[model samples]
Target: MRLIKAARALAGASQDELAQEAGVSRQIVIRVEAADETVTVDAVEKVRAALERRSVVFIPSTAERGPGVALSKTG
Candidate 1:
């Protein structure tokens, strides 16, 4: 999904980096991001956790705006 790509970008990570962090293959990340394959919830969770670790937060869509990602503020 676009959110995944946005989150990765916000994290300043490549697909390979995210795959490594998520404990999945680069191919898996490709497939997931392409939105052409069905991935397991666990796999999705792994990707989310990896992104979260990098301070990438996923925000659900609101009527005013579509779903998006943002980097967490740091002191």
Candidate 2:
């Protein structure tokens, strides 16, 4: 989805880099980013974790920020 691709960009990671960091295949990253089909939660979590480590934050929808991803301020 857009969120995944944004997070990858925020992390300065290519699909191959994200896949390696998440212990998944580059195709998985591509499929996820494209939202072409359903992917497992575990796969999403792995990709999320990889981005989080690189200072990407997944913001839940709220009264303020809304739902999205961003570069962590602390980073």
Please give the CA lDDT of all the candidate structures. Answer: 0.87, 0.90
User: Least lDDT summed over 10 consecutive residues: which range in candidate 2?
Assistant: 35-44
Q: In angstroms, how far off is 31's CA in candidate 2?
A: 1.1
Clashes of each: 0, 0
TM-scores for candidates 1 onward, in order: 0.91, 0.86
**Model 1 spans with C-alpha error above 4 angstroms:** none
Residue 14 CA error for candidate 1 (Å)?
0.8
Q: Would you list the clashing residue pairs of candidate 1? A: none
lDDT of predicted model 2: 0.90
Model 1 Cα shift for residue 60 (angstroms)? 1.2
Per-residue lDDT tens digits for candidate 2, residues 1-75, read: 899998998899999999999999999899889886688878888988999999998988988765898898898
The superposed Cα distance between candidate 2 and the true structure at residue 2, in angstroms, equals: 0.6
lDDT of 1 by residue, 1-75 (tens): 878888899899999999999999998888778765588878888988999999998889998999988999960
Question: Deviation in angstroms for 44 in model 1?
Answer: 1.1
